[model samples]
Target: MDQKTNEEMLMFVEKATAGDKEALETVLLSAQDLVFNLSLRMLGTFADAEDAAQDILLKIMTHLSSFQKQSAFSTWVFRIAVNHLKNYKKHMFAQRPLSFEFYGTDIENGKSGEVPDLTQDVEKSLLAEELKLSCTNVMLQCLDAESRCVFVLGTMFKLDSRIAGEILDMTPEAYRQRLSRVRKKMADFLKIYCGEYGGGKCRCEDRVNYAIQSHRLNPKQLDYTEAGEIPLQTMLEVKKAMEETDDFAQNFAFCKPYEAPERTKRFVREFLDSPQLSVIRNAEGRG
Candidate 1:
């Protein structure tokens, strides 16, 4: 997310803190996509991400008045997001262990059945993109939640260590060490399993059949990517640009950043209309 200027943020914050509906709406709109993507990458599922995004937004709204302007508004928002995700990770782990062992085991066992023939070239291309995303998603689960957050913010989102540290409430040195560990872990795994890193037995083409057979990848009902909505040339252009990055974790860059879903917009609208905000408004007015 781009940093908002101090003056612009202060204007929004003042109005929002004073219970200005439009200013509150604008604040939510500005940060919604960034928060959603952060949740998506942290939680590793759309359903969880959506839930987390809504929760984070409400938290932000509820506490808008308490925002101190010592830091960028984006930084404060991300701090809330990172803290929520860390807590969510704990709750998620208590429910079930998240791991990539199953994916690796499936690949080693060669669970791929007969490959299906999808007639359309577009379907084939989209399926390949989906498989690549699926692979990267699994790879992300290998790291613990905090490490994953650091890696995502640093490598994928291109935030510097100092900024990322502020978001995670760690020292820049600590963030760099964590990111380095994650990078090495991801690099080692990619070299062994990812065909993109060369000399890997597992290929997207090989896994596409397995994904299809397992009902994980449905050509008729593509669910993983928004490739269908995006122009082919545009998608290709984005991929080409990502390929040009001078990074060892190039495969990490291939997975598209999560876009906020329609439901999130509805959630934000409903939140704005709810009686909860009225109480805040009354309180602010009395003050």
Candidate 2:
């Protein structure tokens, strides 16, 4: 978001903190996509990301009054999201953690022959694209939670080092160094194993059938490919413009923003109408 949008969001925050339910909805809606995309990248699945995004939205609501305008509202939301996700233990990937070594081995040993055509009625190319998106997204899980957050914010979201530092509670210098290291690690892994961006021969198209058979991806119910609200070309243009300084930009370009779950607005409406929200607003008004 640009400075104008941030300023607009802050105005909504002012009204929201003062018990304007409509403004509260506006604030939540504004932050929902950012929170959800961050959660999805960090947690590695739509179901887990959706659950985490809702919880993070609630935290944003409960802490609405405490938002000090020292930084962009989106940055503050990112902080809350990072804090929540770093501590979040119930996500599936959190329970079964991943490491680059394991991921590299999986890529190296993964089945890679032409299997029976599983595309059925769907176009083969579409299935291949879905698998490619899904596979690359799962690759983020190989990083530890902190590194994953840094990669998502620094590379994927293109957050500036200083602002990212503010969100992560680190000095800009430190954040830059961490981001550099994380990028190199991801780049090295991709160079050795990922064919799309590197020399290694792991083609996403070749693995589509194997992925479907193994239940890693479902051709019928594609997740990542189907959830994008932003047009791929537009997002690619934005990413291309934002990511000029890295070799892995193409590797990271696949991390596009997804549409927030439709039920998010419904949840906000329900919360706004609830008695619990009334008590909270009353307390904030008193405070």
**For this target, which candidate reaches the highest lDDT against the unseen true structure?**
2
**230 Cα displacement, candidate 1 (Å):** 11
Q: Look at candidate 1 and tell me the lDDT of residue 62.
A: 79
lDDT of 1: 0.70
The sequence of per-residue lDDT tens digits that candidate 2 reaches over residues 174-277 is 88888888988888887888888677888888887778777787767877767756532322212222323456676666778877877765777788788988
Residue 209: error of model 1 in Å? 3.4
Off by over 4 Å in 1: 1-6, 89-96, 114-122, 218-221, 227-247, 280-287
Please list the C-alpha lDDT of all candidates, in the order they appear: 0.70, 0.79
Clash counts for the predictions, in order:
0, 0
Give the number of the best model, judged by TM-score.
2
